[model samples]
Target: MAPTNLELVTLGHRIRHERVARGWTLDELGAQVGVAGSQLSLIENGKREPKLSLVQAIAHATGLEVTDLLAAEPPNRRAALEIELERAQASPVFRSLGIPPVKVTKGMPDETIESILGLHRELDRREREAIATPEEARRANTELRLRMRERDNYLPEIEKLAEKQLAAAGHVSGALTHRTVSIMAERLGFELLYVNDLPRSARSVTDLENGRIYLPPASIPGGHGLRSMALQAMAHRLLGHQRPTSYADFLQQRLEINYFAACCLIPETNGVAFLQQAKKDRNLAVEDFRDAFGVTHEAAAMRMTNLMTQHLGIRLHFLRVDGSGAISRVYENDDLPLPMDVTGAVDGQIACRKWSARAAFSEQNRTTEHYQYTDTPAGTFWCATQTGTTADGEFSISVGVPFDDARWFRGRETTKRAVSSCPDEACCRRAPSELTSRWEGKAWPSARVHMQMFTPLPRGNFPGVDDSEVYAFLERHA
Candidate 1:
């Protein structure tokens, strides 16, 4: 095994050849694979060896088996940097980043982790530099923190929006029905090839000559939408030319498509109907809405949020908290002037205390636990328990709405209770055994809090919609 110089040289040549075939430039390849262009060049020329991980990356990127790469026929040796550049070009990272392909030799160091950290830091620094004022910087920091905290839930919406856009552009079809697109592709005699998730770089590519389509894998459990998207790429290949000039353009086109699709699927009037049902039926939970509308819980919540704001004129603040006391996502109607930095823990605390005090006071006063409090910045408020699902698990949503002096309650104290105390601490305040422990002591027990107000609109606002029509729609749909 130690006597094979030819095997090593052959590997380098194979790597270089694959890189060139992929249409990548050496520098671009180097950046993608976390190596200097010069370093990749050296590897390609057989002057230096790349690490095993790099070889694996090259194999994956070039669609070559690892054993085959290590066993290719040796070619005449080139300059070291040239070989390295060639090797780097044939890597998944390079392909994802749109870098040129490069050939790499065995034994190079793995720099991907360092490179990722460096990139993240650079982005953070750039964001900081873009700020014009301390207040702006603080606000950005708070938003960033909130995003990080709510990433699991918030990011899914981003993905959904992206999918919607792709579908709208005819770049994807049958997103609403997963298997429909795939069956169509099979009928067209196209083989489905899956690539890694590329974030903003996620793309679908078609080879004009060979009719090969490459597409990013679905980020969620369902593959139907992704399959449809892949079939669309195949259609593009068959149609020929008119390639998108830039990734941004592609994304924009897709987003527009999705917006139109959403409008079509969930019309403004339909949204109004959902809101009317919520208004009339006190027993209507998030699940009931999902069942009624044939949508996911998040979708239902988002729809309700939008309708309550845009149509019914409701200013609503909504948040989701899991049983573990972690706040998930928050959506507020524009009219509700809540502070942007409100933490999930704080909202959870408000919810738990309110519920606990209500139960306790109900027993003492010999009355129902439901009551209104007027101490907070939001003024007189009605509180209720709503339920929803989270990435981690199920959750109870505690909703609070201000009824009077909304301006005073906008940023002032809401009630006499502290936002962090556990009402049952003596008996039940142990560390949560789940993943929400990090957010446990913050302020709220729930994962999220969304609060908003509902506004009554004129009869003609939703042209064909009246209160009875809205109720009838819900009855049929729900």
Candidate 2:
């Protein structure tokens, strides 16, 4: 590959240093190399690219071999630092900050310069490696989903482990309470504190040295949300997980931790028994499960999918969507061809407007559940969806199954129907020509505008540190 601009600049610096060491004036060097002094000056300043002949002529005059003059080596290890310093010193921001850039002679030993710049280079490399584009983020999530599908999204080992913990604490099947949470934490020698002083960005923080676990009253509100956060922290203490090495492993470990918490919230044996009875009665509903277990609707729906697919021998799909029609989470153990980009189903991609999940957002009553029968390119599916209010706005959770498998769900009797030729350009995404013509000049509704796109925020094991905040801390210490 051709040399980069920075490499060329370094070469120029090296050439200038060589001439200075030899005490050769620009005119004197130009006379020996048969090139004009102005041209030679330009070459030394990296203002002009020299031909091979010109370079060879200069090499001979400087008492260096042609190959040595054009060697691939950079002039110094701190080349990048110097370049950046020069650019920053010339910028308005540097003066605004009242911090002038440091100036060092080019004659500084390369070894000493390298030692100073090594940490900066390492931090730069880490930041570059960590900035994932949307496609890369989706690919990582897709790999985890495939792994879940490989095992049918069921981790019996985790469930069994959770059950043992429950049995050892003498905590029989019942709604999880604060006392239950305290018992588990005390057994692990962790002090639990609930207070309103924690920051909004934090949900919880564990201080291993002080033996305290802090939960923010503002973030975790109450009820199931509080229980889930407490149990999640408990799982972290009980489960011995190695420090995550990559983002993928981090996500997988988190999913495992979440599953352990869910098992605690709703005991496996009792949950399975309830599901079996519901399946027999042909009235399985997520809302009823939520009422029975004292969990949120989304929690109940997700747990039902896990239990049904893992224990009941039923295949299903689950989706969580935001108010803007973007799918936040999706899991499928069926033949449905979910809408996807090059990576997979992830946040930011708009769901087809005709689908039940997207249509759930338009309902007048956000608290009420909606059900629909829809035919897609993959097959027919019956879906139940409900919208819940959130700090950011509203989000919908949906549980769907193949038409043949719908008999076991409560909304099987619904007659509302729609056809989705989703992911196709000629399908529902296109506006009807007649209606468009009618409103083209008569009405001018403003188009929806997104303030920002979804980017995966870095989350620490401690709730106190959010995504970019960790990077900022690293910068300060580095």
Candidate 3:
């Protein structure tokens, strides 16, 4: 692997600081390290990476160990400033400004460099804060993800409630039918109404006063999302959820409702029995689960996370990735080391291009599930991904497990395999060093900022809900 630009810069700064402290010129250091004065100058300016042997020789001449010379922290404040400036100058934002970077010579004042860094810092802050999403929402997401991970994704209370409701609705075996869902709604003292305009943001609206559940009119018989949405809306009432007090409360309520819906869609009693049979036959598959329950692949994969570890002694990860490789959802109990932002939120992050979720998109056959065993830095993971489309765009839903758990699942013998050294710059995010060197300054491409980057959570009683629009929608239809 090639050295990252920041590493090279730090090494250069350390070497220069050590040489300067020893009261030696570039020529004097070059004589001891068997390198030319111009080459030493290049090394000090963070433009060139020195060979290991030459670095060792420099350490020997400086009366220090190679490790000391290669420490991540710089020697002094001056060296730190130089390193920061060098890194800042190399950033895409700085490059996009079309301003030539200022050289940090000994004659240049530190105040000037600080001023430039301040400007860079402000520009970076503005770019990051472009989206008006609240930090509390992201923190809530991180907290919920961690909480779910801790429990192995199972909620016994919600599961029990769903089972009880299903039993009351006379749903014993097979998939929970549309009739059962309607029955559950009726039992909850609510009626389901199909409407043309159910608010652009709201998936389904529950009117507590009117005892009604309003849903969109695009659903078919025994559909995937429509039933789930209805059950989720009913969950709020059955669970006696009040208005969310904070973002955390809102997120928690949303998760609970979704969990309740999942349990109702794939009842624990039937879903586990089916999974146990499949495990006995060594034929566990997400598609089979989805087919059995009449749910979407993404739904089946996510539902697995809730049941697999607690019931089947299997730990797994789930991912939903869009066509552009952005991760829209994730859940991992197998230490998948997913990419995350500083807030520990995965929403703003992109899945590794080499991941099975991304690789499955390139498969010529989109009709069936794609399987692969990926060798990531965490460990070997066996994954199966199914690609599908929606009004938004194309997406891939994936369920993966650790190598040892592959025995109980289908596609364990897939010849398709990959090795990914992700969280590394050279893995997939950065261009090849050769290509960067060839096209660094010659190319000027306008970046197409992602739509998700600027779209903040909608404001209302629930996130992504519009109160006035829902009221107006109801006023016209009622």
Candidate 4:
């Protein structure tokens, strides 16, 4: 592959340094290398990448090896400063500022260059600091989701680990009890403690030094399947995760811990056994799975995705969409045609209002699961969505499969159906032509901006965690 622009610049610095050290002019070096003086000057100025033969010839003429000419660092401090300036100017951050770049010439004072570099450094540092929030988060989340989809969202190692932990706790072939969860924690050398004074920002906290996991009181709201929180805390220790150094690390660690907790809550061997039996009976339903495991509808739905493709040979997708039609969590390897932003991230992107995830929110009988067959451009899919309320407000959790694979699920007979031409704006996003003609210029609706989108992710060792508050709470409890 050809060297990058930066590489060419550094290489040029080295070549120029060698000739100057030998007190030779560009024409003199050109004479020895059998190249035109102007061409050689261009190579020295980082405007040209020399051929390997010419590089070798120049190296031989300069009494140095080709390796010396291709060294990574610029040959002098002046060259280093110049190279840094050139790179910073070429960056998108610098270009976005709309400042014209200064032309670095031989007569430009080093002091002036240093002043300009200092300003660039400050602007560059600010850019790096702000990038770790949403944009980087979206990119990381998008990449991680694609990876999980590629692997059928199954991790055999985590499944085995869960089985081992369960066996050690003497749990076999049933819904994992709270007692079993505490026993598993004991086996891992940790004790579970419930407290009302736990920090609000933290769902659960692990005191690694004291071998204790602190959780909120049992009476807290949305309490069913709360065992997963403690299990997730234990998972960090089991997985040997450290403080995340980047947004990607934060996202990966979160995914792993959640995967571990899901595996523990729904042991692979027994869970798959239950699912296989259901499939044999031709009666697969998310509610049945949730009742059997005593988990929330969301957990049960997500677990089916993990096992269905890997064990039952059925490909599917899962979505957790909010009442406003924004997708909060999603997974699909079956080409369900989810809405996505430029980064391929579905989270925070609005799901088509025609899809079951959004349609379920409007259902009158939300106590029962909502089922529908959506005829999308990709293919028809059968989906089961269960809407629920939490502190964050209403959300619909859905699991879907292709029209052909819908027979394996219980909601196959529902007459409810919708046709979606999304992501075509005309499908749902655009207003009707008659409405537009009547009120296009007259209507001025107030848009509600979601502040969470503009908020920066919490900074410090652990994301969104206040270290001092956690320590104080642990101290008072200790």
Candidate 5:
């Protein structure tokens, strides 16, 4: 495709910067380029695309070759512009404009492409002004989940890399311990130090120059927390993850690193063997596996999801929620229909109160895990959830499988079950007719029950983190 309007804007900005650095006014540059001052101003502001002759003239005036002036765009910037261009082309309004959709390639005139992009900007502005409701959010989530489903939520490339790393480490079937992690760090010429005063925001920092890794007290647990953090740092070192220039690259890297970390704690082959045995015994329990592997429940649950879907040949799903019933994380490789927003299975949307992930918050005994059978439009699912207190807040993690796969879990016999047709107004959001009749206008002053839903912070790679600070830290160490 031809250079996008964004690329033109970038070129214009560079030209303006060069002119300003030379202390030349628009009229001065216009005289040098034999162009009108007003037109030159527009060209420098990207309001107009200069002709090739003008570009050549400007390049000569600036004592640079035209090729240098129009150097290839940075990869990340080009990708971003291409994404914007694609979105614009796909926009209904753009199609309605009756301008034949054309690729922004060398064949297309830059002026024509810029004109279309200008209209796209107008439509984007209108969209930004429109207030989005909860339903729209749900639709977005649905689309995102659909994409995940397309891939079956499996990363063979990551799995292969993990296996290779595991083999290279001479890792065997055993519980990952603190001493083991420390030894791993030592072998890499890093000294692992635990400090009580490490800031909460800094989980762990590797001082590359000093060959030392600093961890907070809470993360020193000889188990999951420490191991996960250490392994993540090791990934940064071993996998050669450079600072990502785009958000997409950053997210992909984070996923790969986390997957590698999980693999380090639970080697793929060993994890698969244990899960197979658990399936045969019909006694699969996340907590048991967690304790056995010396990993956190969340980690074990993630590993299990991978095992069931990617290796064990059983479809599975996982959900995590905070105390307020806000979804913190969710994923499914099964056909179970999950409530979604425009962005896909979102992180902070309030889950159906009847769902096990939400219901687990009300359990009187938070010490043990909770299980439930839920009937949704998709199918009946059996889920096990555990609520735990973390430094930030109380959270719960739940793993689920379709009814047919329930026989593989120990808590399959629980009588706790509920019907959910969520994202539907007639579902659990409304009280049953029988209950409404009994309580309607009798006991309460207002007679209306309002469920307050709060939008939590967006979750992904470092949901509430200062990413710039992270990059800065990494760069400093490097």
Candidate 6:
């Protein structure tokens, strides 16, 4: 006789089947359900019984009703076949062909069917490795680049058409979000795929297969903008020329557009206004900027850095310091005379000394520490520090402003304390032979650079900081 818990095993198998039908592997299913794949395997293989909660979790992850999952037996042969057919129809072959298999069956020759089957087998063999290896995907991205280039030549015509249509409609006042752009694309009989929050500067790409457009958000100014523009150019190619038959075919059209829309809508010149507002507000940090402008932290930082460098003529250096006093510096500033080269600096030697003095003074006087430290020649300096932890270990981010004494402000410090000893002591002292002679100068061109310091804080919580406050502060100061 079968085990008494045969029903449970059957249910687990059914759940697994449904997940696989959706093109999800067991590990992916387990992750969605907050369980280990090994545990899920045990449950499916009848070695262990899943809890009630696990059953619900599986159902949720698979998008199946609990009742459907707990049914007495596997789906009927017809139902099973239907599921397989759906999966096959959703395959890349069908997508590239720009038609449904049922439709393809009516017109396709036997040779086409065989070729498609061969392609499917090849894709299956490559699927796991393709996903695992970014280098492979990047190499494959060459095709996308070629496709994007082809589309770019025809962008002006597409943009003209879109602009004309929008102008004729006389509707351009409301904010342009991803949903709005998608609706517009749809009105033009184009499908839409949004990537990375659909930044305002996102450019549209045309899908020749489904006659749709894709829009991905632009996060930075220069390279990001160009990429978005390329995407828009690609969209133009799709809308203006190519035709797509199926949804997957549409996705296959490799159009590249970066942040062209953002540049058009939010010009870099406006950055000064944003920065001025941020400076006054004291509350305007990365997250608030992200939410308000719908951008990422890295993007916002780059934008702010650009504005500071370009308009204000301020030099900004970003430093990553490990607990063991290893420092990596990235400098950005067009106007400043400081070398923008990225190099390792002695961690805790300069910045930490300033911090130690500030911390000691703060503790002794029972007063918050805020002062200027101008020892180097590039100019007076302003600095702020924040502590963060990544998979590698704890780090301190020190952002310095060149030639500005008042740039540093006292914010809430981080709760996590740094380790007592520096981790990179040997390397820190191991000055390169080339630099040994140069290091002797009291105020060499490079040594004259000044940097301010801000104490480290937790990653997300930058103590007593808020977006509104930052905006207000910048506005008041401006």
Query: Whose lDDT is greatest here?
Result: 4
Candidate whose TM-score is highest: 4
Q: Which stretches of candidate 1 lie over 4 Å from their true place?
A: 1-269, 276-287, 334-375, 388-394, 398-478
**Lowest lDDT 10-residue stretch of candidate 3:** 124-133
Query: What are the per-residue Cα lDDT tens digits for candidate 1 across 1-478?
Result: 3524444556666777778878877777777777887887777656677788988877877788888677655433333333334444444444566644332334543354334435545644443333333343234434543443342212334335434444444433212444434444444565556655332323554443444455666644444346445644544433342533323333334433333334323344444566566655434344455455444445455545544444444454555555544445455433222323333223323233333222333333422222334233333443433443448555644334445322222222334332323344432345456735666567655655433223221122221124354344334433
CA lDDT, candidate 5, residue 9: 61
The Cα local distance difference test for each model comes to 0.45, 0.74, 0.87, 0.89, 0.74, 0.45
**Best-to-worst ranking by TM-score:** 4, 3, 2, 5, 1, 6
Task: List runs of model 2 lying over 4 Å from the truth.
Answer: 1-134, 218-222, 364-367, 438-448, 454-478
- What are the TM-scores, per candidate, against the unseen true structure? 0.33, 0.69, 0.71, 0.73, 0.63, 0.31
lDDT of 3: 0.87
Which is the better candidate, 1 or 2, if ranked by TM-score?
Answer: 2
lDDT for residue 326 in candidate 4, whole number 0-100: 89
Q: Per-residue lDDT tens digits of candidate 2, residues 189-281? A: 887787655544656656676677777564434467766777787787677777664566667677988898898888889899999999999
- The Cα RMSD in angstroms, rounded to one decimal, for candidate 6 relative to the true structure is 22.9
Expressed as tens digits, the lDDT of each residue in 136-171 for candidate 5 is 445544555566567766666667776676665566
